[model samples]
Target: MKYTREILSDVEGYVPGEQPKSPDVIKLNTNENPYPPSPKVIEAVQALPPSALRKYPDPLAVELRRACAARYGYDGEDWVIAGNGMDELLALAVRTFVDPGDAVLTTYPTYTLYETLVRLHGGRVVSVELDGAFQLAEAFYSTPARLCFLPRPNAPSGVCVPRAAVERLCAEFGGIVVIDEAYVDFAEVDGEAPPHCMDFPRRFENAIVMRTFSKSFSLAGARLGVAVARPEVIAEFLKTKDSYNLNAFTQAAGLAAFDDYAYMEANAATIRATRARLTNALRDMGFDVPASQSNFVLARWNGVPSARQIFRALKERAIFVRYFDAPRLDTALRISIGTDEEIDALLEALRAILG
Candidate 1:
């Protein structure tokens, strides 16, 4: 009757925020792009020949790799590996780099997936909790923790850390440094570049920068993620990955996304503007807002209703948003910025609730 590992008796696997079945819900929960992808994505998918689908997708995924390399500021496709999405890439990294009993370090109240991924690999997690202001500890630089997983403009709270911290970690930590930039483009679109250690991979040996097409590129359904690292590190990851990780549809769509950079840039700008406006609007309405650099905002109320109560109230109004029960983030709600209309609806709901 007892088949589970002893370590898993209490460890809960990560539950992604709700993707409610009702399309009527104004989903500001998971930070998904409110905009549609470029018209070219539609054109590319439509243009895909039936023959491509019949074939097993390209194992090397050459074209996707090239596009990813260019996106990450690398000159060639040599060290870029695309996965089904960033989530898969992270799982592969843990499997490829970590052996049982090997410890990996991450900041808690960051990406919950890192804990699940490492634990599944029989690797122990060493975590430094977010500081008083909900930032990663400065001690991470002095402490040589193995294989740090960092989320830029970290989720659940859009507060960003300086890039110098990542560089310092890479310099000091002997193990790998995977900088997960799922929200980086959205942050940059918001006019904040909190420093990324992506360039260090080419110069030093242990750095890896990862990205996804799901967020800024508005291709969540595409399920594509790319990792940029030294060629050798990428080779090691390739050994761990399933051959056909990136399928034909994703590759084609991603290429179209890269090619239609102007449309992508415009959408990013609109999202940025909306993020700023929503943050200010929420703050003005008496919510304690974090300085958000992502497409989402973390807001705690000014001693009105508990975060849980507000979340439930919003859900009752047929609008969906994120509410976390974890200790560090228990008192706040993470709200993704949607379109102007969506924001207006959310604000209207908040006003009604407060009154």
Candidate 2:
């Protein structure tokens, strides 16, 4: 009586962070921007005419694509593509590059969605484990596969791999290399320049850098994402995208957010400052916290009041943080950087729970 494919039945699918409905809860699990989106975005959405919704949106999302290109230093719109979210674009990458039964590689303890997408596409998933410190292992560079998903400022751990190491992977890997820079906006920059792989698309034909408006731009609800690569590679990706993948409202909101890019930067700076305070506070409390370059930190508790106990205790108090039962992460709790007041509340909660 089962109508689905065997692969679909066997897959466990990706589990996203918990989304609590109550307004009383202090939510710090999903890593959403604690501040509101740019005022320009709000105005743009409100300004959308009723007529705009009467017809189909631009399938290519040209205006939004152009803005992204200019912002990221890409040559033109042809080098970029927009999607419902980075998740949709990621699905497109798997469909475009991986044939059934083909090998798709990724680093373990990375984003689980990558593995889920590859599995849904009937591709073999080859996972190379990150070392003890969450750095890329040598095997990640040499692994043979049709496609590789490398998330800089890697999820759960929030550690970033260096640009030189990324360049080496692109130069040597035989297949496509996707640098998932979902959290790159929060990483420390070098002077005026950001330390990211946005420029890789121009230098490496096989390199594609993907960005999301969810984290930095505060447009997660709008579901906007952009992919940058060589025009030839983008051309192939365009063929696989769904018709009118981006709606009129999302396009307008994303473009407006880009217009006020400074707003996003200022918010990111605030999050970075808060991240430092959160890390230090956890360390002072005897938690093993690795320095995070993203909007969240993984706090590993080694002694009394185990991570699981802390998570459940916090939930009972209506303060939520992320907890993973997976290997290497079992002892840790991933906490998102919330508002200063929210963080203060979490710290106060931890102190009470530990004592």
Candidate 3:
């Protein structure tokens, strides 16, 4: 009676953070931008003509792609490919590059979706466990695989892999490397230039850098994402994408947001400030917090009130943060940087719960 492939029964799909229904709840599980998107984005969406919906959108999303390319200093639109979201582009990479039973590399305790996508495509996942500090293990370099999904400012941990390390991986790893830069916008920098791998696509043909509008651009609902690579690599991605993958409204909104890139920068600055404060506060409260470079922090609680108890207690109070039950993460709670007031409320709740 089962019509699906045998693999379907064994696969447990990626579980996203809880999205609460009530408006009053201080939802911080998902790493969404707490502030609104650029005003230009709102204006652009509103300005879309009703007739625009009557026809198909641009199959390649050229305008949006060009804008993204220009922003990143890419030579032309051929180097950029837009998608429904980063997730779609990720799936495309797997579909275009992987054959059934191929080995796909990913870091342990990283984004769970990477493993799910590889398994669903019948690819084997070779997960290299990160070091105690959450840095890439030495095995990551020598591991033989057809593709590698590495997130800069990695999810859950928010620790960015060193730029030199990435360069080494690209130079040595024989297969394609997809550097998922989903939270690169929030990465704190000591130097004038921000740390990023955007230039890798130009220097290394096997490197593909992916970005999402969901976290920094505040366009999660619009489902816009972009992939940057050598034109040859992008050509294969373009072949796999759906015709008209990006609708008219999303294209307009993403373009407007990209044009006003300063708006996103300003918002990112605010989140970084809030993240510092939250990190210090959590540390003061006895949680072992790593110096996070993303919009969220993973706080490991080792004291009287266990992380699970704190998560359950916070849930009862309608304040939500992320708690992973996986190994090395079981003792930690990942908290997204919310508004100043929202963070204040959370701190107050933790004080009450711990006492």
CA-lDDT, candidates in order: 0.84, 0.93, 0.92
Write model 1 residue lDDT over 1-355, tens digit each, in one string: 2997887876778898888888899999988999999999999999999998899988988987887788768878887988898999999999988888898988877888999988877888998887867676876655555588988878778877777777777878878988898887766633554355568788769888898888889998899888999998988999998878888998899999989988877887788789889988988988888787778999986466888888999999998889888785778888998999999999999899888
- What TM-score does each of the candidates earn? 0.95, 0.98, 0.99
Query: In model 3, where do residues sit more than 4 Å from their true spots?
Result: 191-193
Cα lDDT of model 2 by residue, 252-286, tens digit: 99999999999999999999989999999999999
RMSD of 3: 0.9
TM-score of 3: 0.99
Regions of candidate 2 where Cα sits further than 4 Å from its true position: 189-193
Model 3 lDDT, residue 326, Cα: 90
